[model samples]
Target: MGDFVLSGNVTRRENKLIPHWKGPHRVVVTNNGWTYDVQEFVAPFAIITRHIMRLKIFRDKYLGVTEDLWEYATYANGGHMVQRFLDCKMKFDTHQWEVLVQWRGLDEAENSWEPARILLEDFPLLLARWVRTDAKAEGMRSFVLNETSSRRGK
Candidate 1:
């Protein structure tokens, strides 16, 4: 029941510059009418947002062209595009690395913990950039970077 579609229902202040659509919500249900239940993807993989919108509403969205700074577009092969790697921490129970993934169009507080293994496999370049910036930004030890480099060699 998961498919992406924009929703034109989020409220906003009256402004001539505002975009009409609010989401690339995942479809959750097919109600009896012309409406559908959609949800925004939130962090922790547990929270839910409910917004049911009709198929049209002055047809909200961009001009069908993706901009570089815009958020949450999938890769050509269909997966979330990694906007940035914001932070990292070792999971105490799993004993593995989890990188904080900054999804486009979302706040830092909404970023989710993504497995380093998946990021390494999927978006190595973004992971590398984060490694360099994070180490410099916070004076983190290079042990993690070194570990990453070793993984990259394979």
Candidate 2:
């Protein structure tokens, strides 16, 4: 057996801040017992996004969350925020990253619906599909469509 490892990062898309956690994370991330990882993920955005604040035109425009809020990664130039926590020596199996992407999109849509129902209804699925396709381009195999449930088995 291998020791569990934790890695995390915070991401900003439009006005929302999403925290990402990965363990040698082969499955869903638990919501507790990973404060350090969560803190690391959120600290950067909390520090720099201060200056980017602006008043939101509509209370529920971009989802229920305030559009005026900014995140730490927003200060940087390109690429999404990524903090790799556990690169275990044991070779983890290659799995499709798209399913993860779709799952996240669905989760976000649910969270955002109350604040921004229009976006949840309009573009999230399209965005999720695009992200899934992008993950494929980055060398992840499609787990749901082609292979075994355990990515390691492949």
Candidate 3:
């Protein structure tokens, strides 16, 4: 593969509630599509060869600069509370809902997915916003369906 970045694997050391996907380590070499050699700056100039499944293609916009990655990891690892809720979704298997939250003072890329109930209880304002946004989306969806049906009738 061309220049790419590797994503961090989930670890018990990290808070299980938070959705973590850290990294954008630069790839130094590639052994066809099966494996790649990457450099980890934080690991102190260490090079590692990993299978293709363990790596993700690097996107400059989403990953941002290498410096920012370190800052994000520090903030996230520090157990800082989430700043605000961005979105929410229900889990298909567990039927439990989760919210996408952005931590205070951190970049959007540092946002994590958290359990909706915990967020609602901890940050009540998030519940209000979620209700308002959901209502608006439902209204828009109904409007679209009505318009489509009217056009079909005509």
Candidate 4:
């Protein structure tokens, strides 16, 4: 039941030219062979469930690398799509602004700081959204920070 398997059309497809199967997901529930529940995450939870007929046993080609990433979330030239901008900072030497980019399908810890100039050029809309975020204008006492270790999601 722990073996990975390739999946069929679990999600709706916009383009018909994509690959037929996109996963080698770990089987979470066998469902007695009628239906199987598969999880693509390293975390312990099932994200997809499909009938047995739409699945095929998968064999790993590379050792220790098995996560089936977002086959449909990349940009045209295989670039990572930014989910959002989480933080902002000024570069120490260049004095240029940088924003922390939260990539699609990745966790918060995987986020990275990118040049604001580049982002403003590549993704102006995203940079605009980040600029419009509440501004953390705590100087006006409307928003609070450093009050506690707990914080809400953006």
Candidate 5:
């Protein structure tokens, strides 16, 4: 696993933490050139972008009128075909699908060459746990941020 220095807070949209981030956070660029941000992010936030490639497929297959199919396929196929389609064609943005395609290829190449794993045996409590921060306890109404704090009480 790569080193992940505590970058900072991740913002949320619609009760979920956003995945795509800007600027220099903390990412290890793999040999293939696709970088993996080592910081711990809210689970399943990455899942949202899973269908980004599917959107490309749907756009290519069905044309622009129904990019929604990419999303629909995610539910229907149980998101199984996401990576397959992504590998075949990476489309983070249907408008500029080539960039996405290149990125996905780099990521794939890196992962295949040298895979990363959560070393549970090495660090028993490495996994992050969710914190119910939505409740400001004073935001006119309580709202928990979709984020995780270190299990260590600090």
Candidate 6:
């Protein structure tokens, strides 16, 4: 088997509005009909088997498109590249909140989800924005609900 990238699922955190095409993982084994065992280098280097439907052939075009993705890959490959942060958000997850980031020189299509601790340490301003946006959204939602209830009572 060769190195292949894993496709992201639509339900992944911060991926709801974006395409999920993450990976370049090394293939550990190949199964029947486009399935392969792959390795994820994040954190503790976990191995996962994925179907060919979710895998793509790694290409050079995928690189240099976004700084965060490229830098993370470089680091994972034992290279050093300075990462620049552009924007951040706190996204609600099933169990907890997560940090979604927008990297410099990359559009909305390139923004990816990160851990909240990384935002706190590297980009506090984005964290503040996330808080403000959350508050504004909550306020608007409350106002709408109140108006609807009042109309129903009339």
Candidate number of the best lDDT: 4
Q: Which residue runs does candidate 4 get wrong by more than 4 Å?
A: 1-77, 136-154
RMSD of 5: 22.2
Q: Which segments of candidate 6 are over 4 A away from where they belong? A: 12-19, 61-71, 74-105, 108-154
For lDDT, candidate 1 versus 2, the one ahead is 1
Which of the two candidates, 4 or 6, achieves a greater lDDT against the reference? Answer: 4
Q: Relative to the true structure, how large is the alpha-carbon lDDT of every model? A: 0.54, 0.26, 0.56, 0.57, 0.24, 0.51
- Cα lDDT tens digits for candidate 1, 30-133: 76456566655433222244444433332223223232112232232255555566677778898877877877567778789888777666654445556776
Clashing pairs in 1: none
The per-prediction CA RMSD against the true structure, in angstroms, equals: 11.3, 18.0, 15.1, 12.7, 22.2, 16.9
> Model 5: per-residue lDDT, tens digit, 17-101?
7453221112333333332333223323231211211111112232222223323322322311112221112234442211111
Q: For candidate 4, lDDT tens digit of each residue in 2-42?
A: 87677776454785444356455668887775898887643
Of 3 and 5, the candidate ahead on lDDT is 3
Output the better candidate (1/2) by TM-score: 1
Candidate 2 per-residue C-alpha lDDT over 1-154 given as tens digits, one digit per residue, 9 for 90 to 100:
1112234456999999765533221112333432221212223422111110211111212222211112212211222221111111112463213222222323443322111122222233322233355543233223222322342245
lDDT of 3 by residue, 1-154 (tens): 3464655554464556332444556688877878778876464557777777777765544234444454333344445645656666667898766667778668888998777556544544334434456653242233334444564477
Model 2: lDDT of residue 153: 48
Please give me the total number of clashing residue pairs in predicted model 1. Answer: 0
**Alpha-carbon error at 139 in model 6, in Å?**
50
| Count of backbone clashes, every candidate in sequence | 0, 6, 0, 0, 7, 3
Per-candidate TM-score against the hidden true structure? 0.42, 0.16, 0.36, 0.40, 0.16, 0.38
Model 3 regions more than 4 Å off? 1-4, 8-22, 60-66, 69-101, 104-154
